[model samples]
Target: MSEVRTIGILGGGQLGRMLSVAASRLGLRCHIYEPGANPPAAEVAHACTTASYEDEAALRAFARSVDVITYEFENIPTSALDLLEDLRPIRPGREALRVSQDRLTEKSFLRDLGLATAPFADVTDAASMTVALDGIGTPAILKTRRLGYDGKGQARLSTPADAEAARAAMNGAPAILEGFVDFSREISVIAARNADGDVACFDPGENLHDNGILRRTTVPAGIPGPMRMDAVLIASKILNALDYVGVLGVELFVTPGGLVVNEIAPRVHNSGHWTQNGCVVDQFEQHIRAVAGWPLGDGARHADVVMENLIGEDMERVPELARRPDTALHLYGKAETRAGRKMGHANIVTAKSS
Candidate 1:
């Protein structure tokens, strides 16, 4: 059993901030390691190390200071991870990072597990891009295999003629062409697993994306009973396959054919914010519990919730949002908000009405 008093989080983003708050509830301290100065997590964390991932000395100190290490984001530098893993245990493990760091690898991993995914092919250059387009055809998305999120590093090709522009958008990076899925809506399952191999999954939340960024997620997804079961089962399968410890977010396409896996996030996800108001144990606490070697918590939902993200100028509505009843406002301590920046989120519970 692990006696984790201080948890080390790799990224100091909003997720890290929430994790720190959750750890506090469990009487655990969190140390955040981030390259950026004065990151949001620093406001809540017990300790904050502001240094680049390439700095071995800083990495050594950060790893040695904490009982166990976990990360908010998957794109950590490999060298930094190697140093930290040798000094302390990193939960969710390196294999999860290895698979999720690259979209091509993630898709292949899911495919090998006999799970459904959109058809995808790798593209290295113009020649490969042409070949991939020939196979997957147009009306596909060209995305960088690594380092892409929230609508960045992605291009849409409506016809074969648009391949050149899409390829140019890649900026010479290795890319993947993915055939789109015919889905009615998207949903995500926030799943958790502890070191003991027990798994718990929250009710799948129906997701709505705007400009490729998640705008809102509503609980009691408009899917049928069996699909909900399938969503949970898929999440359990992934947690077990990776031997993952901590919360994982599994995004799926609710298609008429069945549920199709879209992607997986190793850390707590934006869609799971509804759990803050809807469940007894939210994703952040579940993550802290897993990495600290505690038993997984019950994730059953007690109320219907709709979580809406406060992006960029959305901060203007915080006052109005806070004034309403049954609304929980979670704001990240960001000094400035640029366009498309995630300022915070609001979890609004719907009251049962006659």
Candidate 2:
């Protein structure tokens, strides 16, 4: 309720770093609570606490230091939320996390909401896998129920013969079978809802992923006029369903029939990076504004923008990108480079078509 507020963020990655930067711009400060050493976000945050979420003392102290709390990533352990949520508010709240953290639950939640998603079935063991495979059929993907992202923890089944190998990939954890969908293109909507029930959605962005990690996002996604409106409405439906208070990322498949929900992220998403150059209010600042209880900003796009992620050795091209007048580079301050790592991104802006 004040001009100056403190926001505590969970997870210390690039999202946190950008969120902290936006918070600082708005005269708000950020405290980062991360268990990892040399976290990217810790470098830019006003304060950094390196402690395990299991430590109630550390969790409470982190909660006490900030006026409000949010997170850069999902996969936050339930135990940690149980400790901090009592002390301070968690924007987007636990309901969003609960549904998103588990693939099966998230799919069911979307289906129950009358949203279209890939056909899915639960699998906890070899027997269950057989049962699920029999029903959902071959050429499906087997994914762990929890904690899988960016091409990890997934097994592709081309035929029923590949079942055991797929089941073993779970490493004894619960899993789900999602029937493949033939989609024209993959797109995502990044939307924000503040505490006052106000909802604003950025223009949808078409996304391209390289080996499961997002490689690029382009605005004015090729979804025709009517489908784009449906995408926005689907995102808004989710935000309102959660009574969410912050930015949420909704990934969708533009299929022959309609838009099929892929998944939801309860924070600023990489797909929204194009907004930095396209919109008056970028996803990071929009998220910060919502978590800070401030009114939402303009989500209108002023330009056509394509955001390209620099994964690992792709950073080698930064110098070239920096020289381009229409390109804006946002590099994550990380010291090391390795394969599959997200090093930075570039936003290319152009005048909108008449």
**Candidate 2 lDDT tens digits, 1-354:** 655389999999999999999898789899999999989998889999999889899999999999888999899989999889999988879999999999999999999999999989999887888889888897999999999989899999999998999988889889999999999899999999999999999989999988899999998898799998999999999999999999999999999899999999999999998987888889999999999989899899999998999998999999999999999999998999988899999999999962
Residue 114 in candidate 2 has what lDDT?
A: 99
Off by over 4 Å in 1: 351-354
TM-score per prediction, in order, is: 0.98, 0.98
lDDT of 1: 0.94
List candidate 2 stretches off by more than 4 Å.
1-4
Per-residue error (Å), model 2, residue 169: 0.6
- Residue 164 of model 2 has an lDDT of 91
lDDT of 1 by residue, 6-52 (tens): 99999999999999999999999999999999999999999999999
Residue pairs that clash (backbone atoms under 3 angstroms), model 2: none
